[model samples]
Target: DVRTTFKRMAMNDEETVALTAGGHTVGKCHGNGDASILGPKPEEADVEEQGFGWKNTQGKGHSEDTVSSGLEGAWSSKPDRWNHTYFHLLLNHEWESVKSPAGAWQWEPINMKEEDKPLDAHIPGVRRNPIMTDADMALKMDPEYRKISERFHNDPEYFGEVFARAWFKLTHRDLGPKSRYLGPDVPKEDLIWQDPLPTVDYTLSEVEIEDLKKKLLNSGLSQTELINTAWDSARTFRGSDYRGGANGARIRLAPQKDWVGNEPERLQKVLAKLEEIQQGLDKKVSIADLIVLGGSAAIEKAAENAGVKIKVPFSPGRGDATDEMTDAESFNDLEPIHDGFRNWVKKDYVVKPEELLLDRTQLMGLTAPEMTVLMGGMRVLGTNHGGAKHGVFTDKVGALTNDFFVNLTDMSYDWKPASDSHYNIVERKTGETKWTATRVDLVFGSNSILRSYAEVYAQDDNKEKFVKDFVKAWVKVMDADRFDVKK
Candidate 1:
């Protein structure tokens, strides 16, 4: 039978997907001989041939008890290892659909050479791996599935916990009862929220949060501007910041706090908000964590309160920085010389696009999808500051969405920067052409790898995917260096 249990529970595409994707982490498919005209079967092909192998499991020899689900090939870097690599691989790369030897639909890497394939951990007797099936592809296409999968993709530890919980529930359904295995139940009253406790609270006060919103809006900065300013602060750290206790929010130290690239005003606003909050409550939370959370959380909250349809997730566990680590020299190397948008204003083309991208990729330590989402977000919100006109969100003013990438890449409305010094990407046709694609923004379309993702977000059917991707990226940037983050 099919995954009747999974479908019956109305499990979202992600949970079902994680299971299948994770399940395939260690198995191989049973491919038919070259029966159809599609291509050679796995055994018929050369040892290093790179492509996907698929088959239909509904035929004569197939049995209901075999859990093939019509997919086969390596799902893991080492097809025999059980890990989160499958989710990472799918999220990080573009896959093309193809017909298998058995005339089944499946997805495989397009034009991938042997050396170009991702390296899996070496296993004792394993040979090779191939691709995902159409059902497997749904995990990436379905908004909910893709979003959930990012949890696993971003943090393998978290994935393991979620999978363990899910697997336990799925396999233990028939076992007994409300209290038997979980533990003796505590009093129900233990779950109630305590009210009006002493204000030893460290988090931002409601008034500070509200007032910061006013400043960010009044300052005329876009969402990307605010988020990028905040994200950029923590984006640096040559791996040393996380080792000793020295890392926290040292960005708040005097010289470090005042450094030119800190965009001092951005964090100043965050600090002002925190200071405003400190006057009222004795906060237990550090100024560092608040700054990180303030970017995405505060912005989204203002939008939500005002009735804009944007939602972002936030968590607080960041520790504060000591003044000793905040030397002027300590903050020097943190400013980025280039990113997916520009090397510097008017300097995007100074270096080859790939070289510029490589510099950014290494600097931010972002995966391909993460980088794409960040680029789209920054471009859309006009957050790049130097090139304010080069984003789709610039025209909309303050709604957070993927229309920036869509508008930049859309074929229907021709988007071009204004000829004047305004730096705006204008629409030749109707709806208020206030956007512009800067050198960096243009690369998302020009670069082969970047364009695939840009095109995906541009499609009408993929709007949800775009939203989830942006939110995920926002969270990643905010959480990148926060110590004590949960798995």
Candidate 2:
């Protein structure tokens, strides 16, 4: 059996050596000599045998001496390796050497000359030209105009009107009238009614003419009264003037006012119905817990009256040091405390403070006292570990050598345990002939851990009692669990 053993040694900084034995030395030993480790040459080795060619000349050099110095040095000094340089030159040479399958050089016809080759034997009417026809060029340049022409081609009347307008504009002429400057001319009326006919000679009864005058006067009075009315009774009766002058002269009555005479009763009724619907919705859905009424002194006072807990950072004179509310002092005070809460709300509840606080209470069961303790613990822990060096362990056997554990000496002096009570143990075990190993591990209190535990408890079916019990346990651990207390 090929038995093996491991061990860890404790030494000062000056001692620096690693020793291991028992495995067979598998390959040729070089000791400390560098000669046999030299690499291979280029020319002496067969280009085909070594699979090195012009195409695969990634490590080949331009100069013979460079190539003879072996693959690495040759590749380092090679100029062909520069991007696109060798590729373009190689492609150009390959293209020049390539031949057509027809196997003979042939010239294309320049027009239909007899001396020149007949138009390409393979393709007929495949002429090459430098310029296109005017219509083709126009279609290529103005595709939208081609589309419009195709769309209106079937409508002769529309096409005719457009064509006529274009023709008139281009010729600077009008088709409507032939008169100069196209103005209207009035016609003179004939004077045929100038001569009066002879009278009938029979006279009308006096009472009949008098009654006719009275009837005509009464009709004019009725017409004037209809026109003078405020409501435009004539315009309303006349269908031709239905929309004419109706907008400006229109009089729409406003709905009657409510008791306060502020808002109309119709508007108030709509608002009252909406409010009732909202109240009904409120009964089914819950409002957020822990509503933070920032800048709302009135709402804050209302909350106090309602016996809800409120958290204010700090104030100067309230009575107790804890009771006194204080303004945020620096980024340190604001960042991990205020900003941390803000970030928590943003990430979890999208920065809605009420939702954030609600989630904080619901998901973590974070009561005022519980939150204060967790925040204070996080502050203390952050200050301690912000600059401390982390511990290291060995690879294969999962043991920590004294070299790796040396940082622990200063760690005990720098690490401030969040709690007061803790313990540690070191164990060593015997291995194969003349070998031993030692292992070390540490455990400590953390706000993240407690919060995670609280969240799990809060999400349980029996959450109220579970959260209460979890909070008690978390407080006990925070107050008592301890590791080394750094000065």
Candidate 3:
């Protein structure tokens, strides 16, 4: 199966190694896969000892069964979360191939103590410790793989970035269509219609926009979360998953007022306010456009209050879904797996979030550029991967600046491990830290394609440019399902 695992998944050599290293973040091999050659844990064995790989068992449970499968030592010290520590252990320390009691060949740590080991415990099991499977050792078995492992070991940010994309490749798909609707049929140009983008007829006056902004900002709900719900509701109207968006079908729908992301009445609160705001305003513009337009406007106001420059866009054709088109099933189908705040899987997630991020993103039809911008902007707005107010956004809780992207790539804040995968950006002066980066955040900083935008936005003078680019990406998501194109 190793022959086809990477090939079938269409992972390039680099991705193969990165994923191999990253995947061992948690969960131990309980000798269920294959039990042949058996050996002791790394703590009990000599530092330089290698265990028996193919020992002759006189009459084990099975005739041809060897007692060991080289899987014993926990691969990482931090076994609860996703982190580059797998690479760190594989590259920085010595690991000897040992056979597990179940006859599996695995690598064990040479000089590690249970109390002192780095671990990642966020895996599914009660206390899943990291262990290097034979597949994982393949990274070192091949010289090229080892080189990449060392690179990732030394560069956590880069490791996280590569791991995120590779993890996406591993869980969700094989080599398939990049976009659901290809060029010519859907035409990239048609998907992106900015030439005559709609303008608001009954636009909120600056004061009204400000009032709505204050209501939203004080409500403890993220604008990104609100926009995402509206986006999903807009996309789910026609049911084939494509229609009902180009003409703004779901923007004004009451059905989208509550979804998975809008928990505890977050979207409800926003909707309630919008209902109040809509009462006084004329019916020229739609709530969908208002949400998007007001969101960007509020961000502009926040930035201005922070003495930041921004050029926000105004797109107005978003109309509300007239009837109750969306149902409970639609909400379930549209629930977001990859949270944008914590930049990693939510702790409460029953499944891997990476698997869902790319799938959901592709289904919604946002490109890499748009995804990158959305993620980056969300991080600054305290809405990147997982949780809100994890202190990374503690400093600038509501400001929609590019400081997250800039600080990450600029290395202004020294990132240190909070667990294995998460880290806090330490403030150099008072030793105070708040901003943290998840594997997903690393993608925006380390991925070659994504990094270009991060680098551009890191510049001091590109403030407005960053904001404009963020809006462009945000608009793509907001407007993705608006058109009534042929599915």
Q: After best superposition, candidate 3 residue 99: deviation in angstroms?
A: 41
lDDT of 3 by residue, 49-101 (tens): 56423333335533233233334435666655665567766665567776665
TM-score of model 2 relative to the true fold? 0.12
How far off is residue 160 in model 3, in Å?
A: 54
The per-model lDDT (C-alpha) reads 0.54, 0.22, 0.54
Candidate 2 differs from the real structure by a C-alpha RMSD in angstroms, to one decimal, of 39.4
User: Which runs in model 3 stand beyond 4 Å of their true positions?
Assistant: 1-240, 243-256, 306-311, 322-324, 327-331, 341-355, 384-387, 390-394, 412-414, 426-434, 446-448, 484-487
Error of 3 at 181 (Å): 14
Instruction: Estimate TM-scores for all models.
Output: 0.48, 0.12, 0.47
Q: What are the per-residue Cα lDDT tens digits for candidate 2 across 194-276?
A: 11111222322445333322332233222112111211100111121111111111111111112111123433333333234
Residue 405 of model 2, lDDT score: 24
Winner on lDDT (1 vs 2): 1
